[model samples]
Target: MAKQYVRKKEEVLQTTVTSIRHNEYYNMQKMFDELYEKSSKNESFESLMPIILSKENILLAYRNIKTNGGSITPGTDKISIKDLKSLSSEEIIENVRHIVTGKRGYNPRAVRRKDIPKPNGETRPLGIPCMWDRLIQQCIKQVMEPICEAKFSNHSYGFRPGRSTENAIAELEKYNVYSNLHYVIEFDIKGFFDNVDHKKLIKQIWALGIHDKQLIYVIKQILSAPIMLPNGEKIRPLKGTPQGGIISPLLANIVLNELDHWIESQWENNPVAYKYSVRMNKNGSENKGSGYRAMKKTKLKEMYIVRYADDFRIVCRNKKDSVNIKIAVTKWLKDRLNLDISEEKTKIVNIEKQYCDFLGFKIGLKHKRGKFVTESHVADKNLARETEKLKKQIKRIAHPADDKDAATQTYRYNSMVMGMQNYYQHASHVNKDFAIVAWKINDLLLHELKPSRQKGRLARKGRELTPMEKERYGKSKTIRYDSMTGIPIYPIGYVQTKAPSNFKRGKTPYTEEGRKMMHKDLSINTTLMHELMKQTVHGSIEYADNRISLFSAQHGKCAITGVEFRDVNEIHCHHKIPKSQGGTDEYQNLMLVLNEVHILLHATSNETIQKYSELLQLDPKQKVKLNKYRKLIGLETI
Candidate 1:
């Protein structure tokens, strides 16, 4: 257990923390915004060296990397954030600056590779970069992002600064309610990130008005960095951005942006296919004098797309258009980017007849109260997976004599349930579906948590009740063990539903102020009370998470006097088992109580106890629990 941990509830609820920047960095951002604004308005640039190599920008990148959570993982260099922390600020800035300025010829090391378990029980590879290299990449990403963002299509929403899965999902559902477009074309690119053509990507960067020769050479170098696999084998890839690199998402988006533009042209701009409908000039923009904008002011678009990374869905007004557009897109991807679409995975479905899966939500039509409407719900696969997962966890507790007690198991189980509910709270029938899941899962809980009644059950438990003996408990859903611990278990459907958020309208990403408005998170919708309610935090708990966990364990009261904590400043974490006596960092050894109580517990003289006399006054129950806690730590009770 840690000595202490604390944080404001408000901080955890925010969608994102504002990037901490120095005063000088603010001016640099303004300059970057101005340059990016020019490129967005059809300007060209031959040099970005002045901005990229500036000392202020260099320092800012270093600061941001230090703040970033991923900086801890080491690359092939075997230097982590811990090593960087050992150096002075000036020393680190100089080291990063030398590499960026070509003073040391900028040799990038291979990425450290590891695999993580997926939700569906599969594994995916991840690349970890050293802090030094991440600093250089961050320098380029911060500047390049604003410039690319201006020219990037509004429909391409992956890895963008202000965009998220929620925005993309909302856009997908918008066409459902606003238009008669019921046909959907879903396509998966065959190894999108792994097969991205380096030549084609470079051309796209040039097309975006960034033509810095030196910078381009450096980016190419980064793309060619070798991969150090788990088995001590190193492989150099000719194509594909490694999944875990800092700039991989931006690089992938640049490759996909080309696809976004070509699709937009065929759907809205190019007149060869829609000559009978509208007239257009050579450039993709509409001809204002030709009444092109006015003619279709009230008309719904026949085709459009919403893309996140490699996943995309094309919606059309009719099945004929859907099939044609799908063919056109397949040909276009091969010709323009030299990539192939997965024929086996791709399909065109009439959404009105059957639903399509996108971003974990089922998008299709629903007949409700005499009207047919489009709505998204949790996929059946996810519900089945979660149900089976709970059953397995309950079985471990019931049959096996594991190290974990009933109280610890109950807290962890509840935490897992709360996290799942938080993710799917936006689904339309989530409450209804989860109620069914809860009904099934709670039975498993009741079976394990309740003491056994059979003859064999008593011997297995070491001490238990018989069939003739009786016991009292709360509602069937609530699991309990004793006066303390074994918290009530709630299920997925417990959380209230939250509506999806609409994107910032009429604001372009080119300007500094416009980007500011787009980045604002005014909604305070996340509820973390259940996250805090867990009596024990599993695995290695973060400092903030430990504070929240112990706060729940205390029930927000001073353990000695049983008084509610009026302010967070008064709360303190006490060690139940002293470190000198061989207590480790495991969370079970710590307790949250009042500052006065913690000081009195460590008091060596009678005068010290008398100094905190008011706080020492406890009722019979508090005195008993206090003495119990004291005995564990080898101390005498006041």
Candidate 2:
């Protein structure tokens, strides 16, 4: 038989004496003598071991002394352990004093007496020797022991083995690899940490033969340690520690595995074969008469506990089977370990049809055709609304200057409009169109102070004034006020004493270059109208020169009606002509119209003009008339 390496208590005491002597400390002789005597009494030498080992330098010196024995002499030029141990108390005290005061040729290993420099370069005394180290030692005694004791029954379960099983199940489900229809169930154990039974844990630790001192220290650390939350709240662990810690999952899995074993033994004795079998087919064809035929049935022959730190997933089959299993597990934990489930955190959800979110992974049902659906479709209507509102607000605040703001607003508006156009692509419940419209309105407000490109002159010429336009033109420009603060801003320029002749004659303001300049001064008022009518008309006279070239691209024709123009200058871009007639400055509303015909159409009622415009179907009356003339020459029409 191999020799048993028994460590005697007396040997430990001797080791301590040797360690103290090697440090060349004189006053410790009495302390060493007292420790030896205490060890002989057999009255708990373990309690004093930590105090003796507390000084790192002394321990290191003792180790050196033990390693190099007789080769070291007492009082030779070289200092040695024998010299330290053989010296009288008075002699050793004197040497210690000399070393401390740096009088006996300064020992480099001795604690330096230099002042600690402040941040500002000023020096101060090195306060209290290793105060934190001493406190840590004391804290270790009070904390680590109790924690270890409470955690005695805990064991670690590595991820390698568990992940292999999970992956196997997934692959088997993929190729219909298993003969049986695969079913997975997941359950949560609530209030796991807070309900840990400290007393039971301590008893288990004692059963393992761990000393009381170590157990006490571990328990104290668990009780005293504080956890900081993301919201700045500090939480102290109550029953058990958080599951996110490195060792928590393994420990929790081991405890739950024990509970599972106990439950299985009980079920076997009771012989609830019918219940177990029924659970397996709860959602299967066997339950056709149970008013749940649409749901597939599954058998529950087994259960497993999967743990990621504190989060526990109890996977099983059949509702009744799962419920019974949960009840048994809960009871076992409560009776034996005093652990309770957190009802609020615990949830029972369909593992296959809907996803179960556990340990940051989402697991869901697999289709009969072998497609695995792992993601849950979560519709957060409020969140979407808030996000859209924030986006609009950000766009508004990002570029507030009127000139720069206009393009940004237009871009946002166009993007929203496009989304509405593609609204069918989104889920029916999303309200994508509504969101887009809301964003459009926000864009309008952001660019309220900006100017718009003027419509071509010909399209506006000869257009009659509507009652709304008359009122708008007649009303004096009032000082605009801030919507939020209600602070008024003075108008930049004075309103003209006389209305322009272009307004009276039904001619577009773009008839003369000088008139275009005058209109630029009035852009603040006309720009809003221009944007509103952009949905209907092509030309705006407010800022015409810059836009004239673009209008000529389509030969000054109405894009929708295919109305062509003979005199390019005579074809003016119309707002589908709405200053306020429920029209907006969108491309769909814009059309090229003959200047005179446009004026005539506006002079007529909207219903009457719409009828005529629809009849011609060409660019304007001039184009239609010209076509009729050509046909007459060709003998095609009268």
Candidate 3:
């Protein structure tokens, strides 16, 4: 009976493959000709296809199967990873290779609908790609990653290599610094993943010059095939590219690239307004004493759009342009791509009217020392909401009556806390309000350890600890607790709220231990600060702590004069390039100098600064800062 079942499945697969081969929808000749044309221009589609295809082997298939983990839900064929693993590794690899080579038919994917809870108490359908189907998708993704990485725009920060939510937010913040920002349009596509027009997506992929035969065939099947819902109902979607598959994001990005291109084209005609320079003197106004410096002029479009997956934030210089942009983009998505724009979700607001929120950060333009800089803060409301949600979840899992072990409870708690922290790290890094939230969450984590009140002889306030007690305890901040189990629970850790430095205790909000703890909590490496400071010290680097550290590291002495300054009031932070020429507050472009030396450096020619730097006999660190500064000012560095 089992042999008969296996034979029947093989017969069906053979028929499917035959149909795929004879499917006249794709023009093989045209695909080949296009590949040949692309081959002439550097590394082309065809040139790389072989390498991508060759990578499908037994080891990878086995690894992906093992990594797929527990759900093991079956596809349309009712074959799960458990069933697939029943076969030998060689057999599994051969089957996958055959499918990849178009010798076997692409299996119909089964859709398992998962209800993902949203912030507003609404749930959305997340389509779970089937076990076998996901395995194939993983293989395709591994091969296609390197080939696709370079093709996407830098403005896009979704699921691309070396890009992330932070990068996207940072770019948006950079734009906000210009101060000409008039309106921000937060655009949304209705049912973004589920509403993708399959045919339209295919055309967009072709437009991107991706026409590899196997690749196209796999995509077509993925898009056009019917999905079997859990209720034993098989439905073929009329338009949408299925939501929860590996290929879905890649496909969506390809379609959205068209929108990016359209935006860039329109910008050639719509230039932004220019205003007075934000660069300032110690008194917080442009240094008019140097000479009559002209304000920076703008020639490019005064508008830009940034996207992450389906979310888009468009910035424009004026209301007229904002309205026009929203209309154009709406029409373009509808007419060109057959995509629906969510009218309710598409919002345009004056930057002066209200702050724009995207990817969880509240973005607004703030006037800092007469210059406008983008101010980003995590919403207190959001942090509170997440904290409450986490409390509810932790209570359910770590119930007093539950039999779960400490390790299991700890694992669950860590996952929830880490995920929340990562999402809110940018805001948490600056928001003092986050400490309250963290304290509450820490209390929950403490309870999970089943700790009781500490029962020990306590010393009164102002009494010194015994010598043995002092020897037994170091300076780690901890909470003492007696445990229900024989082992006592140690301190429950809290997120550090400051950066550490060598400055006096009250000088800055950061401390050495606090900075290290903060970095660990944020999952950021200290090397990032070191790397930024290691480069030529400039104002373009916006991180103030590292800039101050660079100055302190150099012993508060003017790099040129080698004169020590006991008071920060005597020092000036100078921009390598004058504000009139588009210099920014980045660390690489800023330097601390004596107030007199600063005035001389700005008043004199670039040639004189270069000569001064040479005669000053700068140390290695100072030399790097001077060289970067010289490069910005178009002077030859020694």
Q: Candidates sorted by TM-score, descending order?
A: 1, 3, 2
For each candidate, the alpha-carbon lDDT, in order, equals 0.64, 0.36, 0.52
Candidate 2 achieves a global lDDT of 0.36
> What is the C-alpha lDDT profile of model 1 across 1-638, one tens digit per residue?
00011121222222122232231333565776687678778787777766776766776676666655567777888888778767765787678767766666666788888887766676767777666878788778777877888788878756665566666677777777666567889888887777888888889888898889878887887888888889989888788777777788888889988888877775455454344444455534344433334434434346778888888998887777787888988999999888899999899988778888776667787767975676667778767877787787666546544333544554455556755666566677677877888788766666655556732221111212111111211222333332222233444446556655544543334455554564354232223333443445443333324455455555555667765453333457777887789865556777777676787777768876776544356567876877787778777886
Worst 10 residues of 3 by lDDT: 1-10
Error of 3 at 451 (Å): 11
Instruction: Give, for candidate 2, the lowest lDDT window spanning 10 residues.
Output: 1-10
Task: Give the per-residue lDDT of model 3 (tens digit) for 1-638.
Answer: 00001111112222222222222112222332333334325354643445433433333534434433333655456666777757765676666667656545665455665566666677666666766667777656644543454345556656553345665676676666644665889887888777777787777666665677667777788776676665767787777766667566677788787787677555521222113333455533343322212212333335677777778888887888788888988998899888778898788987565778777667677666987755555665566676786677556444533222422332344345434443455542444555676577567755653436643211122112223223322242542322321111222133332211111111100123322332232212222222222233223223333344446455445665565442333457777786778876665656777554564454356765665454344588766765666567665555
Clashes of each: 1, 62, 18
The RMSD of every model to the true structure, in order and in angstroms, is: 11.3, 35.0, 21.6
Residues 562-633 of candidate 2 have per-residue lDDT tens digits of: 333322233455555364666555544555555544544444356545554443444555555534433433
Best by lDDT: 1
Compute the lDDT of residue 409 as modeled in candidate 3: 36
Tell me the lDDT of model 2 at 314: 56
lDDT of 2 at 330: 68
Off by over 4 Å in 2: 1-190, 204-218, 221-300, 342-347, 368-638
